[model samples]
Target: MGFGAMNLAPVYGRVEESEAADTLLAALDAGFTFVDTADIYGRGSSEDLIGRMLEKRRDEFVLATKFGGNQDSHGILIPGMGRPDYVRRALDASLSRLRADHVDLYYLHRLDPTTPIEETAGVLGELVEAGKIGGYGLSEVSPSTLRRAHAVHPVTALQTEYSPFQRAPEEELIPACAELGVTFVAYSPLGRGLLGGTVRTAADLEEGDWRRGNPRFQGGNLERNVSLADRVATLAAEQGVTTAQLVLAWVIDRGALPIPGTRKAANARANAAAGDLTLDASVFRRLEDIVPRDAAAGAQGNESYLANLDK
Candidate 1:
């Protein structure tokens, strides 16, 4: 389990100024050693926060951040950002923003359709040799791409949407990672907070919340999804664990390191405690029956966001 720093920024909604530091400290104090962030999150604000807040406790955690994808002035994704040259610049910039000499793990935020995986992996391998990063990984990429990149350089981790809410990875991606010895990092393990039992409807999200724009949180989809999650929440109640903890525990049972982001210290502690929650095989089977891979309604990301992701 790890702390995902994306929500520390304003991406989810309006966060208090001290929220980032509070969440970071809480996560560290709660026994989370891995923290994941992205350069694109809050347009570098997340990285900046991590750098500033963790400067004193840098050795306490394994820090991971990603690059390769960027947005234009209008927040439109700029394609072809994964070129070797761009990756060099991006890593340097990320290192600067992170106030660190090297990250424990660095990942390509998304694959560059225009740039071959082998070429991008080659540069990342060189960076590892140069000590710019401890290791390199890829995000939202296909199994074949993973193999190609791994042939060039071993991928430290593969971060993607993996949860009871999103299980497309189980079909092949997760198997491929296990086969190649790549660590599978599961982001949004709580279904982006739906499995946390807070988001009941679209209106539960504040104005400007990123999930508000996600198709899964809209209209009929949100209704159906929440209905399914509520069932799991009830099972959680029976199991004497919080909904988020149950979800995280299930994710762990599936052999993933889940990194769920949060904005509150209380939520951070609750999420971290999921690591210690022991569930038996019967509980896992019951949960699986409650919410299967295709149980969640709508897409994981919006069309625009999905366009850049590996299909």
Candidate 2:
């Protein structure tokens, strides 16, 4: 139910325009009508790719995109969301690149500590009035910040990193969303590919790859994490499915949609199929015992991640 463009472009590789177009078509064919992207991903390349691909079937999909953090009027880098002018200009540029009159879901990619949340919400609400966005959302926000934003407007969803390894959201954010009638969008539900047991060691990571810098996948932490994945694999074997399927099923079981990103068509199909894997109560209990909240081997992220999230 969650499809995003964060991993499709320059971060993974310089995707040829032709291949990129094919991927979008493949997604649509597979019933993934909701596509998410941020202005910062590939500095707008991902949105541009989506724009081109949707020319023929714009009515067939729900296009979701985000703005916030720093970017020029044209969506080039600046540094922070300092004022209302920044929000207006950023949305204008995103709309232009996406080649759409309005986005179905617009999100604040990060909370700008320097700017008052009220002021930010005011501008986003104005966009909804101007027919530039159909709905608004927040990412990585705390329960209090979510309340503040919701008071400003009806927040349709709250996007956060949620998984067995990252249980912080369940502590407060998930319940807050439920109370506020906001859909919970769980990003990185596969634990950055760890639950799949593909990244066996630090050597398996490519130099300069984003996963290398991730604390959960580093040093002895990687080995310890794999031990947990082995338990998942065992459960999957009993069910006659892949570990990835089991992990995804567990996330869906938790009442949140798991949005994982990958470049391979086979992987994408597998992920979508996991939405159908109904884990029995016994398997779910076994999973909770094997990878409880504290069993995760490393910090979800260091101070940098905390710095980026809403307080």
Candidate 3:
């Protein structure tokens, strides 16, 4: 299992440093062998925190980090930068922040429209050969883009959102990755806490919480999605598992490695236990009947962010 480090940062909400660190250690103790992070998450705070928490036990986990997003001085993600020179600088910066000589996997956080895929792949290949990163992957990219990059260098994985609420990847990305022999790494498999049956209304989110602006959580959409979540919760209750575990089990059964993020140690343990739950075909059919593909209320992200995703 993998642990997503995004929520450990203050990006989602105000996170206590001690609590976040404890949660990370708890995840490791719980048998999470892979830990994922990004440079833009919390404006580099995610990597810095992981560096501090895993400094002594770095070898215990397979570290995966991403680059390419350009952030301003204030930590706002502006756009993607995949130029050759930027690639080298970004990797060096990430290595320094991670306090590690190399990462198990390095991903391009987003496609840089300004740079050719071949050029980006070439640089990543060089990094792999130079022993800076073991493998390279891409996030939120299309099959065509993956093919183009793979032609230059093999892509180890494709990190994207994949949940009962977000099944867009199954239509193409998943099959493409399978055919290419590249692992499909799923992030946000819990639908950003929606499928967990915890967020019922806007009031549930803290001020400046990013999900507040998500279309799925706004207006009539929120009510509709919550109704769907309630149905899933009922099914989970019947199966004697948390709603999060049921959803994660479904994702894992679909052949994707899910990296669910949480801020609490209890939540981390709960998510880690999900890997052991085996959902029967009856449960899968029931879940499918409850949450059909593309049944979500809105797009996975807002317009500006959606624009960056490879079509």
TM-score of 3: 0.97
Compare the candidates by TM-score and give the number of the best one.
1
lDDT value, candidate 3, whole model: 0.91
Taking all chains together, each candidate's TM-score versus the true structure is 0.97, 0.92, 0.97
Cα lDDT of model 1 by residue, 1-311, tens digit: 89999998888889886977898899999999999999988889999988988888999999999998786655456877778889989988888998999999999988888888888999999999999899999999999899999999999999999998899999999999999999999999989888888898777899889888798999999999999998998999999999899989999999999999988999999989999988898998999999976998998878778887886
In model 2, state the lDDT of residue 226. 87
> What overall lDDT, based on C-alpha atoms, would model 2 receive against the true structure?
0.79
Better of 1 and 2 by TM-score: 1
Which ranges of candidate 3 are over 4 A from the true structure?
71-80
Looking at model 2, residue 99 earns an lDDT score of 89
Better of 1 and 2 by lDDT: 1
Cα RMSD (Å) between model 2 and the true structure? 3.0
Q: List the residue pairs that clash in candidate 2.
A: none
